[model samples]
Target: MRILLSVLALMFTLGLTACDMNEGPAEEAGENIDNAMTDAGNAVEDLCEDAKEGMNAEDEDC
Candidate 1:
């Protein structure tokens, strides 16, 4: 009898907790996309700066 009551109590508690869980993955995906876009933009900006520096150095050497 005690074991049955314990099992039922555990099940009820877990049910209530699980019911509140957010199962949608869209928010996580959106955050990932935003981070990726920021990284890409930063990388492009860095590349442009490096290229500009190289061009200026070449100009100085010539």
Candidate 2:
């Protein structure tokens, strides 16, 4: 009985590990989203700076 119980417990632990293995793809997708957002934010900031520079004289506040 004890050996059977131990075998069942081991199988259950392995099953959970198999489910956890799928998290790698999710983590990778999350990282990709994060990088895209950062790039977009940077582009917006650069455009804002360019607009400000275009509207301002050499010594005036924009």
Candidate 3:
């Protein structure tokens, strides 16, 4: 029973080692999301500034 358990453990470890595990794609996706959020935030800030300037403009035709 002890030998069987050892063999089973060895097989399980080998199986885990044989599988492919990587974080490259996940890291790239996270970076892309961060860049997108930054761009969106900047765009919104610019839009808000333009709106404020328009609201405060002296011209009545807007």
> In candidate 1, what residue range of length 10 has the lowest lDDT sum?
53-62
Local accuracy by lDDT, each model: 0.82, 0.83, 0.83
Residue 17 displacement (Å), model 2: 8.0
TM-score of each: 0.53, 0.55, 0.53
Residue 21 in model 2: shift from native, Å?
11
Clashing residue pairs, backbone N/CA/C < 3 A, model 1? none
Model 1, position 9, has a per-residue lDDT of 100
Q: Report the alpha-carbon TM-score of model 2 versus the true structure.
A: 0.55
Candidate order by TM-score, decreasing, is: 2, 3, 1
* lDDT per residue (tens digit) for residues 1-62 in model 3: 99999999999999998785665888889989999999999888788778878789664332
Evaluated against the true structure, the overall lDDT of model 2 is: 0.83
lDDT tens string, model 1, 1-62? Answer: 99999999999999999887574798789989999999999888788778878777553221
Tell me how far the alpha carbon of residue 29 in candidate 1 is from the true structure, in angstroms, after superposition: 0.1
* Per-candidate RMSD, Å: 7.5, 5.8, 7.6
Point out the higher-scoring one by lDDT: 1 or 2.
2
